[model samples]
Target: MVHGRKFISVLTLTVLVLGPGAWAGTETGMKGALADIPADVMGFVCVPSAKALDEKVNKLMQQLGLAQFMPTSLLTLVKEQTGVGDALDEAGSLALIVYEPASPSPDELHNAAVILLPTANAAQLLESLKAGEETDGVRPLSFFGRDQFAFSKGGHVYIGASKATLKKVAASEKDITSRLDPASLGHLQTLDLAVWVDAQKLVKLVKPFIDQLQEMAKAQAQGSGAGSFTAIQLRSMTRSINMLTEGLESAQIGVSLTPKGLGVSFLMATRAGTKMCELVEASPSTDKSLMVGLPADKFIVAGGQIMQAEATKESITDLDALFEAEELKQHCDVQQLGTIRDSIREMLLALRGASFSISALPESPEGLVGLTVVSKVVDGQKWMDNLAKVVAACKKVTQKEEVAKALELVKHEAGAATVEGTKVDRLSFDLAAFTEMEEKEVEEMKKVLGSDGVSVRLAAASPEHVVITFGGGEARMAEVLKLVKAGGSPLGEDAGIKKVSSSLPGKRYSEVYFAGDRLVALLSSIGKVTGNELPIRMAEVNAPVALVSSSQGPCCQVDVFVPMEMVVAIKDTVMQLMGAMMGGAKQTQDDTL
Candidate 1:
């Protein structure tokens, strides 16, 4: 795209130069000047030699009927005697002579001398000479002054002057002397004023010759065709000139010629001054959608920090050993396993060594215990495998006779077992159960007492009053309340039936019974008080059944149907219970009031 823009600028410059208005004045001047020379002299000037100049001048004189007066011998004699060579050597001193005579002269008497100057400034000299003012030997002459010499034949103007005046025409003579800078005019006298004037005329005649030479150049460029040779040659020559001057600085140019038109283009760098040009001859392509493309350089970078953090969090330790384990054979490629393991192990090690802390709730919510593990360097995969093994081992140990025996001994000493085990570390189940029951009692009290229909309304009616209502009235409510307050019945004592309270003012009654997973008390006034018989529907908890048979080597399946509603209720209840238990001490006023 950049190259194309440059090409158009060059083409536009060429068009401007060749337009109709260009060179108008120069063309007019060339035509007017050349018309004054005789046709034969014009023809000689077109040739490329000095010998042709003499031959053409002689022919022109004969054709003008001056052959009888100005004989060839006389012309030769005049040329030899005068020091005209020096005048011609000087810049812009050459001129043509025209003579007017009623009859021929014995000494070949001279006429007006028409000097040709290099530039327009010479026209002033010619004008001064015609005015005949002796001002520093320079004079101005008119274009028509040559007619006074009787040499204006065929509508061409001529100049006339005497031999004395010609000798005194020292302006050009002085110019020649200055240019040569000779100490004396001794042997150099042959190169005199007349000779100088003649040389200037000869040079003026050579103008048409130079034009013809340019024409020849045009012909060569166009292969001698008359068709637009000048324009073609101008374009070719200008292109060559531009290439020589511009293309040397890494500038490139191209030209194309086609049946329809010609095109040229150039490209240059803005910063380096380097350029390129191309010319293509084209008719518009038939396809309208052709596209051009330009290309440039671009740079980019890869890899960042966030990815490292994510990798660390998910990593496990001892991943290398897991890679070597046989159990992973079907799931992972053995060769790549080592690599995967190493990377994971390194990541785990990084995470473990990092100074960080994490807190997690115990797997069993009944235990108000939390598990906190500090970051530590451990084989991550091995740790995970060992954890699984510990769970399986612990489950087995829980049912083992040895573990039961140890628990029995502890219970004998402490009145309750509270064994703490390692591997699958846990406090004894009995102690855990007791702790759970106590927490549950506090939670249930908050729930029942905090409700607006219960605590608020009842407390408003009587601040210290007790509305002891249960599924089985005052007697059963009293026993259940006792069990809650004392944590559990004394370890070895047979919990005696007793009437702790009755709704009927001073009436008291009691009966003992075990009911529906809870111990209960019965009274005559309060029917079945202790056990509320919670509305629970039994749900079959399906455990995964791992089966191994010869046909199906190792397969596992689960037969289970979980009560979705129960699970949701359990989760909500546990959350509420936990909140209440944690806040219980602080919320005592809220509960009672």
Candidate 2:
């Protein structure tokens, strides 16, 4: 009654209302609908059989210990809203595609996705949406091929960024799949959760954006619009950007389920001749050193080549031109070094490739934490000698005031400790004694130092290793010896761990291993503390994941393995815990009212 095209509106409505029944045909007609999808796709996530995926999810839910807590009603609502009904059992291949834009937008780029379904389900998908206000906006029947129409058959629902992309794809004789770069698709074919990115193509796509941000960061650093910031900070950001830009060519990774755990095998390539390339080439093959003397009760452990040391030295050319005394100023107090760069440089000279770990002292439990650091050296004796010279030199000049300030609370004294019948330099701090000092006296020291107090016990654990204890009571030979003896039963001796370690190529550079039993017990204990009992105990599902980082050819790879069942159990426990916490919080508020 109102518009210029009332008849057209009526005609459009009739087509949608009347055409659906004819299109809904038999489910059998939906077969092979997935293959019809246009291959030329920027990105696509395919569900070959929704029924299979749904059933698997249901089976997994049943296997979960706290299946009762799952919100089934919510899932049912989602299925109804998404327009994929239980008829999915009869529905064949469904793919959602993200088509690349013909040109990039300067602001708020719009995109489109085409939801591909079986020809039979297109009508059902649209009809399912009719129950709500969703269908009210339908522009259907005005455009399939002639009048820039709103709807089309051949199994696709246009939405958001995919609207135009689908229209273009509809006219093409060949699809993206047929025309895609073989290099990209072949790499993806090798992986379960496959991803293939052409490094050069990605660089072109993203680097300009990064360059603009870098310039902005530099400009902000030069000005004061961003509040408290420094040129040094801006410079650091630039370095980070450079680091991000380095060594990326192509990467391929695969994920698969295994009896041992969820296994991931990945391959990443880095540009040649770059600093990262050199570092990767120099990196040792294994991370065994990190766990060399590790104990099962440890929390965090790490090991890797001393890339920083090399980088520090490499920052300056003609290294020998700078004498020992000049180099001393490079890595200590800014006031002491004259320049921060100098301080960083000197510190680098004494550091090298090493491995280390932190663990609770068996006797003191969590109260006492111990750290063991081991360094690789051609000659342990010579390495210690050079290190001693560096430390002694650092003490005599420029860097001492900074050291004194740092250890002001801890009365600093030089001593020697014998470990394995060898004399090694030692430093001790007694927190108990430090706290007893007069407030006035402490304040006076802090003026020259800082308004903070920290005490640590340090020892040269061995010629090639050092032990630094934050809370472990005795910092002497006996304690250090206990740590040096990486505990038995687990750690270096566990059969499963050893097997995984052995499988990695090259000498071990670094690794992170979680003891299955220990990790399970620790996590389960949290439930007990909160008085929220889990339906099942972690001990029943003993699965361990090992993260091994090592170098392979021109790339670096980290392989991780954990069991699927273990993953499910962990997820269930966490959800239950969160639910309990939320419920308790709500109850507290209710009681307050």
- For this target, which candidate reaches the highest lDDT against the unseen true structure? 2
- C-alpha TM-score for every candidate: 0.13, 0.60
Candidate 2 deviation (Cα RMSD): 10.6
Candidate 1 lowest-lDDT run of ten: 294-303
Predicted candidate 1 versus true structure: per-residue lDDT over 462-495, tens digit per residue: 1111111212112222332333233332211211
* Residue-wise C-alpha lDDT for candidate 2, range 1-593, written one tens digit per residue: 32224323323322222221111122232223324556555544443333333343444455555447644533244355444465332334444444554443421123434444334555565554342223333333322221212243455554332335546666667653463334333333333333334354455556778789888887886674332335445656676558547766655554433233355656566667877667666665543445544444444333334434445454443232232232343544434233333433443455555545454343322233345555544345555454454444444434456455444433433345454544545444433354577766554433322222233444454555544444443433354446564432235554545555543433545566554544445344434434554554444343345676666555766667655545676776677668888988999999999
Query: What's model 2's lDDT at 427?
Result: 43
Give the C-alpha lDDT of model 2.
Answer: 0.46
lDDT of each: 0.26, 0.46
The prediction achieving the highest TM-score against the true structure is: 2
